[model samples]
Target: MNNPTSGTPAPDGTAKPLQERCDNLMKRIDLLITIVDRGKGDKIVQALRDSRVTYNLSSVGYGASGLALVDMLGLTSTEKDIIISVVPEERASEILNILLYKFDLDKPDKGIAFILPISGVSGPIALKYISGLQQARP
Candidate 1:
């Protein structure tokens, strides 16, 4: 009997190993973090949604730097909106470009956005959810 959990068969008629498929999927996952001025979290989250990101979290944060130089340079703000998002690695660059150009994150005090490699996830269920594969399954 064909196992549903097994990887799909290749052109040569041999099934690709499930572990290999899972590893590939995991490798394609990445974390995107964007820090913006207070009250801008919604815009950032909306951008992620428009980019097809399925999962994201946002929270308020305060700049911890107390250096006089930072204050003098107008480089710090007391209130910040931190947004954490899950995105496919292949689309990470494209999304970042959107944030950079559209949001002006490259300009000082506008905001900062970056991508981090996700080494692992809790389990397949979580992985599928983050990867948006769960929605593909009926």
Candidate 2:
């Protein structure tokens, strides 16, 4: 019989599935977006999963309604989420877009998000763990 993936090995030979064994290392970034109906920054942190959050002067609202809404009182009370996770670049864009539309990000500053490059990754074996995690998740 013939081999589809070179199905059989050679004399005293070792045949392994051909996967790229490259030394080229890479980093990935994950983005997360959260939205709340005003005055709920504290609730945002409560809703997070697997994150150690530290916000920096994050504020949102229109006018004195600020954080509340004009039709409403006290700060409009609206907020958004922009989360970041660094992984392999191969998976970065996937996660970015996942948050973009998943969180209705196209509608102006309803929310903002982006990703950046990272350096000094260990190696592929270390990176493969992330891939394994993905499989285990869903």
Candidate 3:
């Protein structure tokens, strides 16, 4: 018999192996981190949503500068917004471009964004939710 879902026949005429089905469902995930001046977290989150990202966390942060000038200018600890988002590796480049060009992250003081490969996740359910394969629970 053949596997109706994958349209591929099992070698021994049995249900397709779990490994084969899992291979097709798994996708590499990356962590996209963005830091911008205060009050920009909401905008960044919206941008990620527009790009089809399903998981993101935003938090407030403070920037510490060692320069004396910064202290004199009262800017040693500047308020910032830190946005961490989970995105698929395949879409990393496209989203980075959006941040660079659309958000002007390439310029000084505009903001900064980068991607880090995620080695593992909790399980398939978490992976599917983060990768946008399934809707998040209300």
**lDDT, residue 93, candidate 2:** 62
C-alpha RMSD of each candidate structure in angstroms: 6.3, 10.7, 6.4
TM-score, cand. 3 vs. native: 0.77
Whole-model lDDT values for every prediction: 0.80, 0.41, 0.81
Q: How displaced is residue 8 in candidate 2, in Å?
A: 25
- Global Cα lDDT for candidate 1: 0.80
Stretches of model 2 off by over 4 angstroms after superposition: 1-19, 23-82, 123-125, 131-138
Top TM-score hit: 3
For model 2, residues 1-138, the per-residue Cα lDDT tens digits are 322233334345644333211212222423333443355434444433223222223345432323334536543434443333343456556655655655466775445456556543465545545323333333
Q: Give the backbone clash total of model 2.
A: 16
lDDT of 1 by residue, 1-138 (tens): 333345455547666677766554554688999988899999988988887787989999986556888888887677999999988788899989998988988776788889999977987668878867666445
**Candidate 3 per-residue C-alpha lDDT over 20-109 given as tens digits, one digit per residue, 9 for 90 to 100:** 655545667899999988998899888889888879999999866457787788965488999999988888999999888888887777
Best by lDDT: 3
Evaluated against the true structure, the overall lDDT of model 2 is 0.41
TM-score of each: 0.73, 0.40, 0.77
- Angstrom error at residue 101, model 3: 1.0
Q: Over the full model, what C-alpha lDDT does candidate 3 score relative to the true structure?
A: 0.81
Assess the local accuracy of residue 35 in candidate 3 as a C-alpha lDDT between 0 and 100. 91
User: lDDT at 94 for candidate 3?
Assistant: 95
